[model samples]
Target chain A: MKARVHISLKTGVHDPQGKAIRNALSGLGFAGLGEVRQGKLIELELDETDPDTAREAVDRMCRGLLANPVIETYHIDLEA
Target chain B: MKARVHISLKTGVHDPQGKAIRNALSGLGFAGLGEVRQGKLIELELDETDPDTAREAVDRMCRGLLANPVIETYHIDLEA
Candidate 1:
């Protein structure tokens, strides 16, 4: 099984890195760009066969070690 | 229009960040976890209305600024 976690900052959190990318894009002459946000994508291969179990464990990982809940939000996707 | 860029390292590239996450997960008692890889996701709000134009512009942005072609690969998704 495979799982993916997408971790991103909450709406109100400051994202300087994202802002930098937006600025860089404009500087490169790619026009008509609006708000740009950046996040993390984590791909995992799991030994667990059940999708539900894999998702549950990955969710726990997100809460404990993967994401900082105060300012970040995360969602898990499990693939069988 | 909205576009998302998923940027990830190529197979041969080493990802220490991912390894660290795997170690942390195991330390936190996450069992049956295998290889973990970390990547970047950039979300963009584009001013262009046409999907093709938006995709092309984002593709250029990926090649020029968002991703390092030597070690990373990127795919773009467009949403209306």
Candidate 2:
């Protein structure tokens, strides 16, 4: 099985890294870019598992390890 | 319009950050986790634009700013 999870800062949270990257993009000549926000992509390979069960496991993993819930939220896609 | 771009280190490239996160996951008791790779997700809100031209522009953005071609590759999803 494979999974891809994206974790991002919640709306209204300041993102200094994203701002820095956006500034760099415009400085490098990308026009009409309205706003930029950055997140993390986490790809994982897992042992054979039921999709629903695996998703539950992953949700727990995110809550316990992959994210700092106070500042971020996560979404995931799982494939077998 | 909106776009989400994910850029990752290619296979065989060393990723210390990924390793660190994987170790942390295991420490936090995520079991049966085989492997992990970390990447960046960049979200952009753009002015109304043709999808094809926007994709082209974004490809340039990745090549020039979002990724270091020496070690990364990127994919994008565009939505209006």
DockQ of predictions, in order shown: 0.91, 0.84
Positional deviation of A12 in candidate 1, in angstroms?
A: 1.7
Candidate 2's docking class is high
Return the lDDT, model 1, position B78: 93
The whole-model C-alpha lDDT of candidate 2 against the native structure comes to 0.89
Compute the TM-score of each model's chain A versus the native chain A and list the values.
0.96, 0.95
Candidate 1, residue A40: Cα displacement in angstroms equals 0.4
The digit string of per-residue lDDT tens for model 1 on A1-80 reads 99988898899899999999999888888888888999999999999998888888888888888889999999888888
* Candidate 2 per-residue C-alpha lDDT over A1-80 given as tens digits, one digit per residue, 9 for 90 to 100: 99899999999899999999889998997889888999999988888489998898888888988888999999989989
* Clashing residue pairs for model 2: none
Could you give the fnat of all candidates in order? 0.92, 0.89
* Interface RMSD for all numbered candidates: 0.6, 1.1
Give candidate 2 regions above 4 Å deviation. Answer: none
Q: What is the C-alpha lDDT profile of model 2 across B3-80, one tens digit per residue?
A: 899999999999888888788988987878887999999998888489998888888999998988899989999998
Give the range of the ten consecutive residues with the poorest summed lDDT in model 1 chain A.
A51-60
- Best by the lDDT measure: 1
By DockQ thresholds, what CAPRI class is model 1? high
Clashing residue pair totals per candidate (backbone < 3 A) = 0, 0
